[model samples]
Target: MKQRLSLIIGIFIVMALSNAIVPVLPEYASEMPALQGIIFSAYFFGAFVMVIPAGVLGDRYGRAPFITAGLLLTLLSGGIILLAANPYAITFARIVEGIGAGLFVSCALSWVNMQPDHTRLSGLYFAGLNAGLIAGLMGTGILNSHFGQNSGVMLFTGLAVIPLLLSFFIRDTTGVLTNVLPPVHAIGWRNKWLYFSSFILVGISGVLVSLYPEFTDESPFILGLLFAAMNGATICASLIAPNISLQPIQTIRLASALVGIAVLLSFIAPAYGGIGGVFVLFMVIGGSIGFVFVSQMNYLAVSEKLQGTAIGLLTAASYGGMAMLPFFSGLLTEVFSYGAAFLVNGILCLLVTVTIARCRCALPE
Candidate 1:
């Protein structure tokens, strides 16, 4: 119980510091706006590069060391951002942060899977993630507005120390290192539908992270509130996910539908109800994502022996979508408009939903 508490707190703090900078990053890089997408996606890029290796290493050795290393990297990234004077430096810092996030998440999740009662525990794990994002979005927004970007960056960086310290206390559970690798079939590579659903869910989130700032000319506080509404809804959904029983395919289909509707609504709400409509849609999107995320985690947590590898692949796919899709969405926005990009996302979500449903029918039950 003590270990679980520390892990939860550690993950919450790590995610909070990681996400706190998102809403303010564009403002920090205003001089070269074209690179904003690169900077935003850099973190995920780093995570994508290292997540698989991190998972493999954690499974062989122990998760504790990697968790500590990840926290240290996160602390270093925060410091770099605090002192960075150019977009290049910030991008490097973001990549470093992403690596830290990947290491921490893959290991921490694998650690959680070791515990029993996964349905409830997965909810708690996701709740920590969403809660941290909400804190970061709202807290950083307020701090950035009041103390300027540099100070806000410094403050958030300082907060990383707490998690870094806590990570040292995480119990090492790497027991009986295995020389043999599991069969390829055991890794669930055939579950392409699961991976695709993860990709679409995070792809939409990445687009929102990159483009939502431009949606309204509101103050940072208002913008923060809007993001908070979305993340808050995500927290609620995650906490309730365990109680909402549904088959894996059913959950994916429902989540995909919600995301598609939300994306389509993004185009309409602002036109009719202004920012309020957009805010409502964001909440819907967040809830749907939370549901999808927990459902996937539950599916992967099924095997004690293969859980690490399964989750590693899932993390890689999810972050890959996050890294690439938002950059593409940014290009679309440059060529066309935000609405055009969102419409494309909505269409893609619908298509993916159909594909997953078909895959479900073909896969064994």
Candidate 2:
């Protein structure tokens, strides 16, 4: 078995760095609600752009180099953000950081799917991923209080070194390289619905994190706990879902339904259910997102020849969803009530469920 500790550490740091600014978005963008959405989506946009290319190139060259390069970029982006004089610089830094994340994630996941005991390892990988999100959310909130707006970014940037070093030790899982393009029709086109599932399912959480800071008047620390609660549930679900007997498709369907219901309920949770209700709703959303990720990965398995490309495409869709949905959701927030925004998102979830149920081809056996 490959010593995957390095991969875990690398992913954790990358995820934490990706989200370190979430809790302080309002202050970071200060008075410009529109810029907050732009700043938040910038990373996802970078990731979306980089993932497919990284995946394709990784197949031809190697996954290990991209992983190392990604960490390096992460470190560089952190420095940029730390010294940034204005919002434009910060946004640019975020895009660089996101590009790093897209490279690491697609390649890292392709590496994981190739290993023995992949199901178990995938669970562990996702657990670390969500744990990093929680740490970034909570830690940044705490640090922001004591230090300043960039404090969390500084701390996470410093923490990124451990992974950058660790990534060097990861041996390439794909032993052979080919110059031929992966069969996009087989890996991506035929499975478009599943990819769309990735888009709609995981995206629900992205919408929350992007909008929540402005949605509530809670302090950064309290907001951190709230976001952390959701991610904590995500970690738990990722760890446990792989152990269950359900088929990957079955698990995805169930989780998607729950996510849809939870999003609908979130609108009322703030009023009738109070803060506690909101917390519970967040957990429901988080857990469903976790299940969707694990099941989606397990279900999307392809031959070694197409593994990197397949994982890359799936990741691109996921990040694409994360990037576009929240920005659109924020737009909806501008034009309509928050309740209306949630309603539309919730309906999208159910629509995804229907699409999945209707999808007859390219499903895992």
Candidate 3:
């Protein structure tokens, strides 16, 4: 129970602190439109590079050390972000923070997948993730609005200490396995569909999140609430998705399609439906994302020997898409309209869905 609690809190802190700056991105880097995407994606880039290594090493060594080290890195990154003198410095700090998150999340997820009731536990774990995301968006937006720009940074930075301290008491469960694990490349190829699906599904969420602050005309506080609505729906869906009777592949297909349609519809929401329409569409997108996430994780947890490598690769794919998609979409926004960029995102989801459907690889039940 303590281990579970620690993982939950650790994920929550990492997610919250990482996301707190999202709502304020436009104000944070007002003059650097071209660089905004880079700033937003830097963390994902760092995380993308680290997760696979962390996962592979954790399987051999111990996940507990990596988790502890990750928390410490997270703590350090927050301070760096707070004191960063320029956009470059802030971007560098974000990358450092992302590395910490990748280490903690990949290993923690591997640990969860090794457990007996991973489906239910993973649901709760993802719930913590979305909850932290909501807190970050809403809390930071309100705090920054009421106090100052640095207020939210200060608050979340201080809160990061809790999980770091908690890491000391959490147990490590590394035991030598005589059965040799498959090579990382082989493990990744075996689960290519899962990784690809996770990449596109989570990447869609990233596109909305990374670009929305600049896309919307609302105040920072209101923007936070809007983003919160999306994440709030994600929390609800994560908890409920595991109980659904559909197979993992079926759920992924439906959810991915739903998220695509929702994103496409969002182009017209603000103009025709107003803030309420946009809010509902965002919720749909979030809910769909939650469904896809849970389904993919469930599929990946099928093999105990492949747990760390598969989860790590899954995470790396997700972060890679998050990093690349938004950065490219931002460039599209500069050349075209936000609507055009969003339309492209919707199309990309549909393409990935079609590709997955045609793939011959069967999903684990």
Candidate 4:
């Protein structure tokens, strides 16, 4: 139980550190508004680059060293951001943070999967992730509003120290495995399909994270509250996931429908009911994505040998979507409007969900 708690807390800290600057990032790039998306994507781009290798290596060696090394890198990245004066420097710092995130998340997930009660633990794991995001967004917004950007970055830097300290206690479990695990290619096509579908679901979250602040001109406090509400909903959904009795595919389909509805409502809500409507829809979307994420994690955990690789690939795909989709969504926003971009992406999500559901029927049981 102590180990589980520590791991959960470590995961929470990593996620919080990753998202700490999200609310303030737009303002940070106000001087170079045209590059906001690119700047925002640098972190995920770094994660996408490193996740696969981290996964493979973590499986071969042990997760503890990687987790610890990742946290150190995150610390370094935070220090860089705290001192960075130029956009280029900040972007580079974000990439370093992303690589650290990839290493930490991939190894942490694999560590949790090796535990006995992974299904229940998976829920807690995701809850910690969302809760961290909530803390980062809310805390950063409030702090930056009062103490300024440097202070906010410093707060994040301070928070990183706790996890870096705790990571040392995480057990290296590679010694317990009796047989040699197969290569990455051993992960079957069915799992790949599931990963792809989950990736699309995650893209909705990326879009929300990257662009939601720009959707409104409200105060930072209000924006923080809105994002906090959404992430709070996600935490609630994750906590409830263990009790859900639906099969994986059914859960995925339901989550897909909910996310599509939320997106459409997001477009309609602001125009009609204003921020309140959008807030409610964002909560729904967050909950739906939570369900999708936990379901995918549970599905991947079924294969003991490939659990690390499967999760690594899934994480990579997720960050890849985060990196690519939101950057284009930003471009779409420039060409059209936020509403149009949301609508288009929402429709694309629905289409991908339907196609994946159809493909599932053809897979060997």
Writing each residue's lDDT as its tens digit, candidate 1 over 298-339 gives 766653465556677788888888877887888898999888
**Candidate 2 local Cα displacement, residue 328, angstroms:** 2.1
lDDT string for model 2 (124-223, tens) is: 9999998988777777877888998889999989988887887778888644478787776677766778888898887788898767777776666677
Query: Higher-TM-score candidate among 2 and 4?
Result: 2
Which portions of model 1 miss their true places by more than 4 Å? Answer: 23-30, 172-177, 181-188, 215-219, 358-365
After superposing candidate 3 on the true structure, give the runs of residues whose Cα lies further than 4 Å from its correct spot. Answer: 23-30, 34-37, 85-87, 174-182, 213-216, 358-365
- The superposed Cα distance between candidate 4 and the true structure at residue 97, in angstroms, equals 0.9
lDDT of 3 at 339: 83
Task: Give Cα distance to truth, residue 199, candidate 3, Å.
Answer: 1.4
How does each model score on TM-score? Answer: 0.89, 0.92, 0.90, 0.89
**Best model number under lDDT:** 2
- Best-fitting candidate, measured by TM-score? 2
Q: What's the lDDT of the predicted structure labeled candidate 4?
A: 0.77
Give the clashing pairs for model 3. Answer: none
Model 4: per-residue lDDT, tens digit, 337-363? Answer: 988888888886787667666534221
What do the candidate models score in CA lDDT, each in turn? 0.77, 0.82, 0.81, 0.77
Name the runs in model 4 displaced over 4 angstroms: 23-30, 174-182, 185-188, 336-339, 358-365
**TM-score, structure 2 vs. true:** 0.92
**TM-score between candidate 3 and the true structure:** 0.90
